[model samples]
Target chain A: MSHTYRYPRPALTVDIVVFGLDAEDLQVLLIERDGKPFRGQWALPGGFVDVGESPDDAARRELEEETGLSEIFLEQLYTFGNPGRDPREHVVTIAHYALVNLNEHDVKASSDARNAAWFSINDLPKLAFDHSEILKVALDRLRAKVRYQPIGFELLPKKFTLRQLQHLYELILDRELDKRNFRKKVLATEIVKETNQFEKDVAHRAARLYRFDQRKYDRMTKQGFNFEV
Target chain B: MSHTYRYPRPALTVDIVVFGLDAEDLQVLLIERDGKPFRGQWALPGGFVDVGESPDDAARRELEEETGLSEIFLEQLYTFGNPGRDPREHVVTIAHYALVNLNEHDVKASSDARNAAWFSINDLPKLAFDHSEILKVALDRLRAKVRYQPIGFELLPKKFTLRQLQHLYELILDRELDKRNFRKKVLATEIVKETNQFEKDVAHRAARLYRFDQRKYDRMTKQGFNFEV
Candidate 1:
């Protein structure tokens, strides 16, 4: 313990809560611990932050190392630094949250993780360490943020029907929205553009498909547009 | 270094952006550094996190020790952890932002601070060690968050006229809002209950004052009430 600084330093780590939307509900990616300190228990995919490495980079690297997922957009959720959170020593973990399309990426267990699986947010097992609290905070952020920002689109396919879009919002918000009012408000925002396409396989009616207009959203955002749902 | 951990841990710190409002514009509290490594330069009031202390506790303690302000409601804004942020070492700071009523508290320069003072957000001197970036992030958070949440009330007196409340919003948001529309929306929220008292020392017509009903807001929030201004 003979470093340059006089005070004792706390160890730092990074953890990420990855959210994916499926047909019925919202799911999160968890990895089963392969080593000590809660072996055989599930936790968020993360590890120690290397020296001279940014916390953001550490989060991405650890997620890719343990879950085989990369190129995903991650938002810094919050930093958990309770002294008693870690068992070994004073460790603080910077928590981040990400949204991904469920059908796009497949997770593989690697690194210090024994197994990687997706569990519905409603039906999660007892996680290791203070991970359960981290996941709850991430879920609250996702629920609150999806209303003002269009991040829920990250959990959906590129081309989708209005019903599918509403379903994404409903799943994240954990409530059923009025169809007519939801459609009216979403259309009024003018960020979802109507594509010259329709749903392919449907029994009753084939609804028209729409795509999120990023350029329009960006331009409107610059013009101080208020996006609320 | 002979620590139990295999990897070297980066030093952790906490920096807080303290914001208060006046009639003219928004202001932030800064302290002049009294030690080496950017000594004599103005910076946000903060210091290294002590061992075995929570980051939130460190934030409150540092704010009180350096600036003599305590019991302020501090919100975790964001964590800035780039390697080059601190020239002395690889330091990661968990940043927080707080809003205070300008007339309530007085600040004294103590601990490592040579002098403490409030400056307008639009006009700030050259700050030390990525403190400018931290202040900017805090200001952006305050501007974006005050609209959706009623955190702006923290910067106002317990009993305030509607005009004073509107002026507070206009200063923080940096925009002019229609008087009729602003009052209509604020009244519609019903969180700001009208009081029987009226303005005392005004040259113009005395407007009725109001106070924020925290109990009602809490009850309404549990029922899924959304506050927007």
Candidate 2:
């Protein structure tokens, strides 16, 4: 089937930047393109928006189809519509960013994706089509948002040590924090609750685990409680 | 001339929510449509993206051509691309929000806009298409963003009294802030510099005026200064 327009329209696409936390650094997901026009180049896992599907739905569908990642919450980041960004035509991409637990989303490249892998944000290769710029914007947003909101919990395990939580912030913010001050502020915020659990099977002493108290966070937010780190 | 695609593509457009402040309340600019499908209906001032034009450029051009607004910084808010948003065909709109000094920009309707006027956000007519939803989202963003960012300065005059500044926050946030706390926080941020000027032609004792120091704001932001009101 073919469709024609009196005036040419820019082809719409959706790109996603997925961030996950590993032991040492923050990571982003990239896929090797298998088609012409930047084929074999590493790019964000995304595709053209299908007809009858909303951009949000298209983002979710493309992420799952290409990278085997689903059920993750995706937030609309920005729209990149530079005329020559896509060599094939005037393709405008609505970019989105997501946070996921690395352990839960075991990626398997499928469909149009030649290969998919996670690269530490600190070290990344040249990306195809303005994706590097898009990823940079997403990182800036993540850094600013993580400080004021408790979104860092999305990148950690359900039960984690305070040290682990602090490490997540340090990685995202790219700065060292005073250990005592970090713990004091986090506990004072009361967004994380102590669990009657601790780590198992480690050479070093195990630390008690805590869970993010989402209900308390929501309640406190309603009452205008500010969360900062 | 026309172009054809192998698969149907959603027509792309841009919609902007321009916010300004009046003496009494926060206001939004709306244009009465002069075209079919929603003739005489109030809607956000926007139009279709022409070929070879970026969405950002399209937004600025449309805002200028339809509402006589130019040189305003427009931030991309979100993409609304649900099917049936436009009765004509599948259309995807990249939404943007901007802040303008009400006293500086004088809006005059042209092109497809039959009339242009400012309406208090609290009192708006039935907007065309999904604009009401779009406006609601913009309002939510503005309310949340103004709390942490100093964008509110765009609404007031170049030099304003502390009372006017407080009123801007109170109106956007729809709440009464403690006068002492608000003043202290504003002063401590150091983003607002006290001017050697005071209010002129007032019915009572004139209050001192201040100006938003963008240079100081940028420098302090680089040094990790967070502004909260």
TM-score of each: 0.90, 0.92
Q: What does candidate 2 score on TM?
A: 0.92
Residue A93, model 2: lDDT of 96
| Tens digits of lDDT, candidate 1, B1-229 | 3344455788899999999988887999998888888999999988888779999999999998887888887888899999999897789999999988877777753554269999998899999999998998888888877766777888888899898889988888888988999899889888899999998887988999999999866665445454455
Clash pairs for candidate 2: none
Q: State the lDDT at A54 in candidate 2.
A: 93
What are the runs in model 1 whose C-alpha is more than 4 Å off?
Answer: A1-5, A109-113, A180-190, A193-208, A217-229, B1-5, B109-113, B193-209, B217-228
Instruction: State the lDDT at A12 in candidate 1.
Output: 90
The parts of candidate 2 lying over 4 Å away from their true place are A109-113, A217-225, B109-113, B178-181, B193-198, B217-225
True contacts kept of each: 0.51, 0.81
Q: Give the number of the best model, judged by TM-score.
A: 2
Query: How many collisions between residues are there in candidate 2?
Result: 0
lDDT of 1 by residue, A1-229 (tens): 4344455788899999999988988999998887888989999988888879999999999988988888887989999989999888888999999888867776753454268999999999999999999999998888777666767778888888999989988888778889999999889988899999998878978999999899976775445554455
